[model samples]
Target: MHKKVKVKPNSKQQKIEEQPDGSLTVHLKSPPVDGKANEELIKLLSDKFDVPKSYIRIKSGLSSRQKLVEIDKEG
Candidate 1:
């Protein structure tokens, strides 16, 4: 599945909120540095989707707050 995620880095807590438009708003504790935020996002999505970390990939916007992520649940 493909998801549009809006990432908010350096948050006090980590959370994922689903929007009405089928997108996601993710609040991450890690700062957007050296891919830490991206890693956190993947981990959170993995847990939410009951998939392994390897199943989640950031398809686009690697360096931006808005990202397109792919989750392969069949894996």
Candidate 2:
């Protein structure tokens, strides 16, 4: 199954969680600009799950705090 996450950029502590509505909540230290936050998110998630960066994708909310990301099952 895929996880839906809320992206929180520029956070003091980085974390990720599954919300009640089946969404993910992430705390990131990267700023939400120039795709930095998104890049960090992908990198973090990929490492967390032991997957390659190319296996993770931002399905939606690219420019917002709430993001829908798709993690490759085989990744």
- Global lDDT of each candidate: 0.97, 0.84
Query: How many residue pairs clash in each candidate at the backbone level?
Result: 0, 3
Candidate 2 local Cα displacement, residue 22, angstroms: 4.0
> Model 2 — TM-score against the truth?
0.84
Please, what are the lDDT tens digits per residue for candidate 1 over residues 1-75?
999999999999999999999999999999999999999999999999999999999999999999999999887
TM-score of each: 0.98, 0.84
Q: How much does each candidate deviate from the true structure in C-alpha RMSD?
A: 0.5, 1.6
Q: After superposition, how far is residue 2 of candidate 1 from its true place, in Å?
A: 0.3
Off by over 4 Å in 1: none
